[model samples]
Target: MRSIQRLVTLGAAAAAVVVLGACSAPSQEPSSATDVPPVPTVAAAGPTTPAVPGSTTAAEVFGPGCASLPTGDDPGSLSSMRLQPVAAAVETNPELTTLNDLIGRANLAGPLNAAPELTVFAPTNDAFAKLPAEQRAALEADPARLATVLEYHVSGTRASAEELRAAGTSTELAGGQVRIGGTGDAMTVSDASGGTANVVCGNVPTGNATVFLIDTVLVPQA
Candidate 1:
């Protein structure tokens, strides 16, 4: 009878241990990555931003409004309008390559960074390269001349292509005049020397300014 009672107690203990082990097993888990919460994927295809309520990308609709204003296929929303912060703004713009190069050469990047509000008419790499070697050399020799020419493209007000077109002459941040005019859909800017630069892609918005992409570089008249 004593042996039988000990055997029964051992059996009960084993059963309880098994029951407790089964109860402590982890609860049902998601089977796959698909079961996880959605995450925004910024793929190589293009930039991806969080979906905004009632916001639209400029790339979705190409128009004159974006032509003169700082425009880009920015990842962020229009409400914020900042594709990148001030420190990184110039680097992100492919069209501003020449301008950036000049800025680097002139060491004006620091002064530009310090400005409160600025509008830049950024020229393509080809535009600067197109200039006569001697003329560019002369401009390089004179920092003031280089700066003045560069500043001609800059305006205090954030002017879109539409705004620039509407107002023929916009007062530049550097206290010079930037003229605007064109017959067809493509707008042209007449420099102080009556030379015109056609708009390639306009209105690329940055944190501090809008960039109007120009096919030709605007030479400052001294």
Candidate 2:
């Protein structure tokens, strides 16, 4: 009877072992298909935004544009011919003082300022003094003669040295052509009488005219 009991206990132990092994076995296996990368897609096109246009800027004017028009601090910018830059130029240049006075006497102040543009060939004081005393006395007595002689030096346009070179002849207000000659600083001009006026000072711009201080007076043509 003891042997029969022992055999039954061994059979019970073997059954428990089999049950534990069944519980330890895996229920699922790993997937065989590898994860594929997501497929790339093209970006969709959209309506483009319009660009802004560019703008233009206006010119700026500073201070007083007409500051040089009257009896301002600027010497050569005055509108009155007597008070104009030519006056200052002659006043300051010791050699041209007599010419300055002559201009005043000839009553050229108003006309010079009234003109839109003019070129003046200014003769020096020495040039006038170099004239014979009788001729000088004669000119002083006749204002019209003095005026005509002064007008002979004036052109209707404000011509620069470069402009004078380009055109050999510039018509004078006295109804004759003044011949431009030479080049550079040595440039000279010949009057209708063949007298040469050397350009002592060139391109002196005024409120209404341009002046070139010359060493000799221009003799007008008949």
Winning model by TM-score: 1
Which ten-residue region of model 2 has the weakest summed lDDT? 52-61
Q: For model 1, how does the per-residue alpha-carbon lDDT over 1-222 read when each residue is reduced to its tens digit? A: 222233335556877899999999988677796897556888676576324321223443233433433333453323234555332566555545567767766666755554445557777776888999998899889877777677777765556666667778877655568788874457788787778887765555555566556778886666
TM-score per candidate, in order?
0.61, 0.60
Runs of candidate 2 exceeding 4 Å displacement: 1-94
Scored by lDDT, model 1 comes in at 0.61
The models' CA-based lDDT, in order, is: 0.61, 0.61
Q: Residue 6 in candidate 2 has what lDDT?
A: 37
Off by over 4 Å in 1: 1-81, 85-87, 183-185
Q: How accurate is candidate 2 locally (lDDT)?
A: 0.61
**Residue 101 CA displacement from its true place in model 1, Å:** 1.6
How far is each candidate from the true structure, as Cα RMSD in Å? 23.1, 43.1
